[model samples]
Target: MSGNSVPGQGAAPRRSPEALPPRSKLAITASRVTAAISRRAGKGSGSVIGGKLALRLAPDLLAQLSVGLQVVLISGTNGKTTTTRLVAEAMRAAGPVVSNALGANMPAGITSALAGAGDEARYGVIEVDEKYLAGVARDSDPVAIALLNLSRDQLDRAAETRMLAEKWREGLRGRDAIVVANADDPLIVWAASSSKDVLWVAAGQTWQEDSWSCPQCGGVMQRPGDDWFCSQCDFRRPSPTWSLAGDQMVDPDGRIWPLHLQLPGRANRANAVTAAAIASLFGVPVEAALERMKHVTAVAGRYDVVDYMGRKLRLLLAKNPAGWVETFSLINPPPTPVILSVNALDADGKDTSWIWDVDFTQLAGRPLFVLGQRRLDLAVRLEVAGLQFQVFETAAQAVAACPPGQIEVIANYTAFQQLRKTIKEAAQA
Candidate 1:
């Protein structure tokens, strides 16, 4: 373990019950009240709205809520929510933890999550949006920061991959937090290279389209047997202390620990490895951490199997091209049916052009059903890929029309939430 690692045992130093100013206390009270009302009204969790109102009333409530707690901020384009859940579960082996388990990654949502935490909560596991990472880090003063893989997502609203990488680099330059970063990705490596203390993990990266060039020298990158280097400059992949080999995790001493996770796909195995690495920083044993992570079968609604319309539907969320590529690997084989849902709402990126980047030809032999506001856009892309698909108006319609058996449903942000709600409502009825 690093010298900077925190001890897991013993009581965390308690903060005064009256530490917050009167106004900040009032803000937290208002936030919790509004969230409860929202849930009762069937609006939603209301984390965003409640936190927005709290911040409006008390702008520094986030910092006030973070005092005396060890915070870990996780940011990435893909797998942030899953990784956050895994880490939070593992950290419980050390002490009580609070997390945004509902997939809200922005400031308002984060505030609501923290405002409701009890005094026994000693650690904060926050999943932050990639763009808001620097500010969150500044306010929370985290003890550790996990920088997962970065890829192209929401191009209509987000900056380019290289630009975001630069922002991360500048944001993390002189920070004292321990940075756990992925060494397989050149962009992630560059972003965390400036940190004083870094724990690099060779977590596999399946999608390499966005990281073909070195972010520093603008040169072609060479990958030689699990290693990457820049041909034009002195930049290369760092030597990682931890790595993932198949379903097993390799520690610094080369000891192998098999991860028997309930989550599906290689992406989740990589997430487990990352979560184990983060838990180790707080003095949790790697074996115990992996054991705790095995209990997380589903995160939010991802990988949830629910019966709707007499068909077993497994829900998978894929918001971008890289995510879609990973999602395709976890579905049933060709003959089984699959449904693809997409939306162009602000939550799901208004521009639908990124769908062209995904290789939809792989679903050629399967029965494909398309739906959502952007069904036509997805149908056109599938048509261009020489695949046949049927368009449906609703998730129930698509599931009812499929052959009565196991089915896979892959959707973007808003579409996935809508499907989960639809299934829940039907089951209640």
Candidate 2:
């Protein structure tokens, strides 16, 4: 047995549980139960533990941490989970890494992910939800933080881009960790500047929608028609430390570039750029990282492609405006048969307002199969937008009605899950 602890050097004794403050068993039990539910429901969709329920249960569970661990927290209106996975994969090349393979970006979901990774991991990479960014910063002193682009998403659950930017700025205030941001986004550039160690990456531009007004001034931001620049204020797209250059900017199938992303849509360039920038920061060589990115199969429902019955179908998760615009723009030359799944309820925030923001007019004259619980809502929006489509009340009926040609299924969070499961079940039968 060790003797009494010395003043400065000799030895110290471990304390028993009575010597330490007691924890609430009720809180621990709740966290455990929540975690089990999350696992069973599958990480594909985080609707198992209600969002409000998860938020309420996370704080107490976070209070039990005695270990000083380094965490990498990433949050944005879009691309958070994909970028988180990319960084985790790259970091894994350097050392042991643990991350939530599923797109669980909320606070309690994050707590659930961290708790499940076990205590042995040397590093942790987590994708935080936009609304919960501040809460995460307050709870965990992350080793690094990545602030991706701010885009208009669910205005019901989340605030406007400016409001979310202000929240992120506040969350990133006192961190000593390195913060990587998209230099191209005016909002991200402004917020990322608040940090000392900032790395900026750009993916150029493709399309624009709500990024019209200047955050600093009340004037309309100026764009050179092709590229976006703010003439109202000094806030402009910064010169990025890393930019997707050369043939890398070309389309995936174009002969100019050898890179082929399984994920469709040009918006994936932004995701790829974010992934590449993250990989470079973690010591993965640019060339080698690009090589690995070239072979990326898919990140689940985010433009994930699947093969069924000798037919190729792509599953695109277009939950927000930016996503919708990007995906719509990628539908050029159009596939023969296209399927869209939409849902509006508690699980998906019951916000059908986002449909108004999508450029469904691009699908004008082209036929699409729109299906889900909120098929009427989607049909109404499409009709208002003057886009033609067939509506189905259920996903199964819509999928069955799918034309025998190549199909592209575009869906949101829950809709994506329902579509995937339907396709899987149909294949098994």
Candidate 3:
């Protein structure tokens, strides 16, 4: 993987400020000023607003910011943030890297992240929203793109699974980026197969509900053992150049590198494999990448362990059924209390009906507590699952009620952010 034949080997050339057009330079200046003002006004990170203004001033600001940088775009239904961080941190071994480390994945936030990078940055690792991949790809001209996995998420606002697959297929049709994609997901495979250059990674998929049907022929899929293929069409899982065998990652040369990641669960191990593959393209060794990734204990707020009310609360984010299934595996065994939080804000999808799709029965035996703006909705779902749970008004109350020890708090997008803010403020106070 470190060979010269690799697409983005060696250090990426730097784009001097003189190379940027006057309009783009002015747009970036305006963006920085707006972001500073927004931060002072306590309007959050201001990446979105700053980027909006930048794009308005210079429509090609993203492309301009990306010039002469080896950009790698990461997108999927889940794990985008963590994988983006891993890839970014690993690539840092090559040179300075600029990334959307806060999980702001849209075009506005992506543009903001790029515009904020210093001239010394040689690599750009941007996590893109699955729906906005097409536009980002068109603008960033990335050397590599990583498609993690596709699953049903925000059904009310997002497209169906196969529809998204088609969009990805069309988006990647003519791109020269080396697509490092998950071979285990049929949707991802169908989408990434459109690319001329692809590096398939056998990252295991925990939730198979969305990929039971063939995306190509609309026929049933045959999953005999670890392999999968369309019963009616030639669409099948590609032989992976990189695969995870237990805790170790096998490279294309069949060399096994053990992944001692601080991030928990098989989902994260899969993410590490994908990150290692992307890092390898830039001449970073798989072993070195794995060593770098092992230090990432938390991403954004997910997996962050905070002390609250004399108890340790571990935060976990699960927005959809597939994500919830993976989150369940990360939770401590029964007798350790759990807090479930859900919200129906615009960012979290206005519909709470998707909660019914998750298998909450796995959490039945655990001491469960529900909170958030939509706690009642979650309560009703838990009741239907025949699970015994208590409803709490806040995370504080939930933690106080649980036995003195570590508590797991699982939440969706807005709910997770709210809890993190509340915990942070309390800690600071």
Candidate 4:
């Protein structure tokens, strides 16, 4: 820590939870009952139902459960689940950590995590929904907040990226939390611009389209070098205290450390760097934090390779254009038959127009087996893009239609969960 300067300027004062409300007995009882009922009814996770009940019984459930614990809240459009997992792993040396393992990120889900937290836990790493960050941040009283890139996702229910950025900026102003933000994303940069005690991490931003315009001046941004700047205003990417130099991470003092992650892709590596940066703020050894993250194989089924009806299929989730772009870059292209699944459910975003934002033309003349509720919509997009694709009414049919090779399955929210459930249950049986 002395050599790296990690515990100096960029580091924030350690804030152990104090003066918080005590654990709510009523909330705990309600949560337990709700969880039991949900589990008995075969509902997955039972986190949300339990959390809703817990919060209903005790509106300040998170504030109560978070007493005497250091909370690190992670919020973003993508990678929240995976980042939270990595953060939790790194935060272990600080103390026992309670995290949202079910990938339920709303207030209800966070309440559920708090309800189930071990009494011995000293830290709570909660994945927060971007829209609910302000309120949740206040409730959890996070010592450190990770603001990953905000993107155009769940358009039916989610605010535009720019609006969301402003909301974050407003919510975080003068807050006691030390914010760790992605400087590469204009939206993320703008969101934390007004925040105090912000430590910037140059975590790569894959979705440039969403942040091409300056959030402050509304002018087109120019990316001259490694940094981006607004042409008409002072808004620009902050000089990152921590940044990725290929697989290596450069800390505040300009010392480089290699990032080794078991999870695939630049995105996961970027996520690891952010978590490591946060851990360093909490006095966790950088090497020790990275070592712990290497053991994490999958996160809430995002990159889990499961037996899909006896055939090996690597499960990948892509909820929006940004997520899809990163997911596409992670895997090999062509000939490898992929099950392209999409759904327009409430969880998947009722509006499917965001599909047009993706550069599906890259897959032109390549083989793609499309399925799910929005498969037909995808077919049209594929057809217009002059891509070679086969549409199947079911995932099983699509899997069968693929060429005989290692299969990669990409699905949206509900479709991905449905596939994960089926494969997991089959494996258990």
Lowest summed lDDT over 10 consecutive residues: which window, candidate 4? 1-10
Residues 197-282, model 4: lDDT tens digits: 88889998878888888889889999987779999999887888888878888888788888778799999989998999999987
Cα lDDT tens digits for candidate 3, 219-282: 9999998999999999898999999988889999999888899999999999999999999888
lDDT of 2 by residue, 158-274 (tens): 687887787788777766767767766777776777776777666644435656776667557777733456776677666566555533642222223334565555556666766
**Clash list (residue pairs), candidate 4:** none
What value of lDDT does candidate 3 attain over all alpha carbons?
A: 0.90
Put down candidate 1 lDDT per residue, 115-209, tens digits, no spaces. Answer: 88888889999999999999999998888999999999998999999999999999998998999999999999999998888999999888999
Name model 3 segments beyond 4 Å from true.
Answer: 1-13
TM-score of each: 0.97, 0.82, 0.97, 0.93
RMSD of 1: 1.6
lDDT, candidate 4, equals 0.83
Candidate order (lDDT): 1, 3, 4, 2
**All candidates' lDDT scores?**
0.91, 0.65, 0.90, 0.83
Q: Which is the better candidate, 3 or 4, if ranked by lDDT?
A: 3
- Locate the minimum summed-lDDT window of 10 residues in model 2: 1-10
Q: Which candidate number would show the highest lDDT if scored against the true structure?
A: 1
